[model samples]
Target: MKAFFRGLVRFLLKYYWLVILLTLASAGFSYPRMIHLFKTISTDPIDLLPQDYPSVQTLLKIRDKLKPKKSFGVVLESSDAEAIQRALYDLKARFERLPEVGRALVTKPGYAFFDKHKLLYLELEDLKEIRERVRRKIQQEKLGPLYISFDDEGDKELDFQDLEDKYRKRYGGDQTGSEFYVSPNGRIYAIYVESKKPNLNMAEERAFQDEIRKTAEGVDLKSYAPDMKLYFGGSTRVMEYRALVHDL
Candidate 1:
């Protein structure tokens, strides 16, 4: 063995340039396969486990049985509440018109039902206070311009504006007057956009997000609010992931 290794070493030293050329040629041939493997690599933790593992089988079963809907959020921001409201509605309408969008909800349908029954959630004392305020408002409207009292009793008449301000202070935290999802200062709104199809393939998911962005570009948000900006969130990150994998 020692004699054979000595002979091999002598031959390699004599043909060093040829050895280097062959090494480079082998790497050149393998480069494409390396690139292909990188692009097709799986980053999922579940994929790291053996396919026959009990946990892996159970997880696969669960995933197959309960696939989640593909959805993303479109956020609208502006200093003007009126602009945000108008743009929110307009954007929602445009998203709904898209063939890729299953539905766009500015506010969930359940919100309307709960809003109608909100008074039922109030306490007895709160209900009584609301009733008294309503009665005073009615009296103040009926009194009209002819009512005058010279008595020293300092009875202040009810002001609807004050009541409205109080109402806003109580229940309008981070929400607009129309009760849409908003930032704490009421300068931003969000619209939930769900895709019409499932997220079965990364390419298809990218296409879905691309279509949404295209639809948004068609609308002039500045027309509704000068400073209004539109953004996307949620599963839209998948687009970036797919782009990175493709570039790999």
Candidate 2:
């Protein structure tokens, strides 16, 4: 052990200067390129991933590294919930008209169980009052339709509850066709949104997504994803369509 130790130390000492000289030489030659590369990389402005979206980032990282995604937005106005739904119908027509959309289909495929924080099936006997009421709620509370659901195990649920409270406080009378109840036969609520269009532009596709999200207002969404009627599946086809066609 003593002999081995002495030899190792002597060997390192003997080669230390050569090692130092080589390192200096390499650094001198490579340092400029490395600096230039770093500077070029830093030319883009620093963008920090939003801290509040850890769970989303984690889930995505498991599939693919977190990539910066920007969503386009278009806000619409309506006097009340009925008007909003009506607007969605009109938008869908216009959306469908914007090019190759002859075969667009919209229907619930499979719904096992369903539930909502509150299901509203309102028939407005008097439209004026409801209009005024809706305007007040929207302007004062900044409210929109809220859909809440849950899957099995009942995990990640507080967001649904929060939206429920917000919806209740915001809307007023003359609303019917709404009830908040859980389906006794529920086991899974299909809890995912996809683009329905098999071929659509990205801008148009994303617009459809925003419109759907807006329309699902007052719809019940639970914590866990349940495979039930409450789970309205959004088509992912539209999302892929634009990207796919882009390559063509």
RMSD, one per candidate, in order: 6.9, 22.2
Which TM-score value belongs to model 1? 0.61
Error of 2 at 27 (Å): 33
* Candidate 2 to native Cα RMSD, angstroms: 22.2
Q: On residues 1-248, what C-alpha lDDT tens digit does candidate 1 reach at each position?
A: 99999999999999999999999999999999987765545544465689999998997888787775578788888899888777878888898888888998787667777678877866687678778867755665678655454544224655356545665688754353555777777777888888887534555666777888888778888888789888887474475565667786
Q: Per-residue lDDT tens digits of candidate 2, residues 1-248?
A: 99999998898899999889999999999989876643332111121345357764565565454332322222333224333333334544554554323322222322222223223322343344456545554544443335222334222222334334444456532121132111122222121233444433445555656665554443332211222122233345444444444553
Model 1 has an lDDT value of 0.74
Clash number for each model: 0, 41
- Compute each candidate's TM-score over C-alphas: 0.61, 0.21
Clashing pairs in 1: none
**lDDT of model 2 at position 205:** 52
In angstroms, the error of model 1 at 2 is 30
Instruction: Work out candidate 1's RMSD over C-alphas.
Output: 6.9
